[model samples]
Target: KQAMDFYDRALKLASTIPELQFPLMTYLGKGNALVRVGRVDEAKRVLDEALAVAEGDSAYGYEAELLLQLGLIADQQKDTARALALLARATNLAQKAGGNRIVAEIALETGRIQRQASRPSEAESTLRAGIDVARHMAERLLLPRLLGDLADLQVSNSRYAEARALLEEASDLLEGLLTNASSPWVRSRIIDSMDGIFLARVRLEGAQGQNASRLFAVLEQARGRAMSELVSARDSSNPAELRAGERKIAALQLKLLRTTDRSARQRLLDEIFRAEEELAPAATESFIRTRASRRKPVTLPELQRQLRADEVFLEFALAEPHSYALIATNHSARIHRLAGRADIRKTITA
Candidate 1:
């Protein structure tokens, strides 16, 4: 909100200045700020205006970024087709502009949407391509999430060993992260990776009778605090700290866009990183608190204990080309292999 306020005030002043006309950049900044505050509708309107202004201008990276942001909004609204279209174009633009990070991110989203839409083949190919780009860029931060996402697909396909390998890689990447100055978003992804690792371990053990005791120990170490402590921890930041950090980040980003000097741009980037680092621990704590406030996740033992005398549970794990199910009755459990999703759907229909 403070960041939005700053941009709002700046635009009001900049609008009146004859020598400092930057309507497109200003609108984009404010739109981004609005997005941070969850004012998606308003952001769409402003970003649309920015898009109109960007056309016929040489804003290569900016144009791609705007499309990506708009695509995210569309995704949030569940407009799958529109989001995919926007993201596809954004991916092309980002790739052409050498924005590998953005390209990887866009690809990840594209693959995710494809998977959601039941286009597993396309999702697998897209995810592989994105992982390749991320590797080329050495995009350590996003790579773990990408790997985890792909591992999930692999799990569903019953590629248990492959999925476990990917999960281990992702978990390793996450383990290397410095938690002290990490964003809530990053921490959330880390937690998600941990979940993926656990799931893959279960699937592997079920399928191959491999003891995952070492893996579980490693996971426990990776997840520093106990789950109970994590659940009980309060938000670490006051409103003032959040507001100040957000404002500084926004200010630095806005300055980065306006400045043409290489040294100045570098300085602005550094400042933005610093600001984000300062906000990371607080954001992470808040996210954990909020997540814990919701329903606690069911443990493997808890799930097993929930089965009734007459009931059986079949936990299906699906990947691109194969599927596996862990079938459990009250007394016994076994792993069964099945054909891919299409075959399963056909069988169910029949």
Candidate 2:
């Protein structure tokens, strides 16, 4: 609020002094403030006015900034199409103005928007190109952010190993940047990236069953750290920082809960339920029938062979069966041994 008030006063003074530069800058600043406060409509109006002035005076920087601000506002509203269009224009203007940093940032943001809209292939290419540009320009801040976004897309597409590598690099870069600064925002971002890496590792471990206990332990520790960070942010005066921390905390909590129980049987059941939910009512009957037939019981030897080959496939079998049969494969005819079967006995006077 105070910042906005000062910008408003400065705008008035700039008008009085008839300084074209200050008024344009002040209007852009005020528009950004309005957007931050969730007043998107008002922000658009203010930015449009700034754009008109910039166009009239041929102020390229101010025009590009206004376009970027409007793009951010559109992104906040989930209007990806408009956001991409505005950002494209801003990137072109920034390129023409030799603002490489702004161009890199806009490209990174556009890729993120594409990723959010489920365009992973496009997001991957766009973000990689942006990262290259950022790296060439030595845009350290934008580089790590773009890398993290790309890593997230990789994870979403089941490229776990690639995601892990990307996340590790992002975490390392973020940590190095944090070491020289006392910026809470930067530290929070680094922690968020580290948490993501740990969560991905946990998912991988859970699937493999190689270190389930260790994975859960790491998840619990990360959840605790995220919650503590949220508490610290809540104690701060910055609402935006607090909100970001709170969101991270919520996401960590939900993801931890979901990944902690990775039993194969449970996962299979969940998958079945999900499929049923997604299918139409008329189609569900056939789907269920097909699923049941697909889940037919296998013999003990077959089950053992499957479990030995792939642990992930173990959840599809019945935990307990009505009978147990031991078959010796070395015998000429495969002798079968059955246990727990009692024959009926009768005692008669004869």
Output the lDDT of residue 178, model 2: 48
Candidate 2 lDDT score relative to the true structure: 0.62
**How does model 1 score by TM-score?**
0.56
Shift of residue 165 alpha carbon in model 2, Å: 1.4
- Measured with C-alpha atoms, the lDDT of residue 239 in candidate 2 is 44
lDDT by residue (166-263, candidate 2, tens digit) is 76676577656644434456566666656545544444334333433343343444555556555554443434543454455555455546675668
What TM value does model 2 have? 0.55
Candidate 2: residue 135 lDDT (0-100): 88
Misplaced by over 4 Å in model 2 are: 1-5, 18-25, 36-38, 182-350
Residue-level lDDT tens digits of model 1 in 1-350: 78777878887897689697456567777877787788888999988877765655656566788898889889878999999999888887787788999888888888888888888888898889899999898997678778877887786688877877887887677656524324556655666656555555544544553433332333344333345336544544446777677788888888999999999999888888888999987665565445444333444444557888898876665532455665666666666666776887888999
For the record, the alpha-carbon RMSD of candidate 2 to the native fold, in angstroms, is: 23.1
State every prediction's TM-score relative to the real structure.
0.56, 0.55
Candidate 1's error at 166, in angstroms?
Answer: 1.1
Q: For model 1, how big is the CA root-mean-square deviation?
A: 11.3
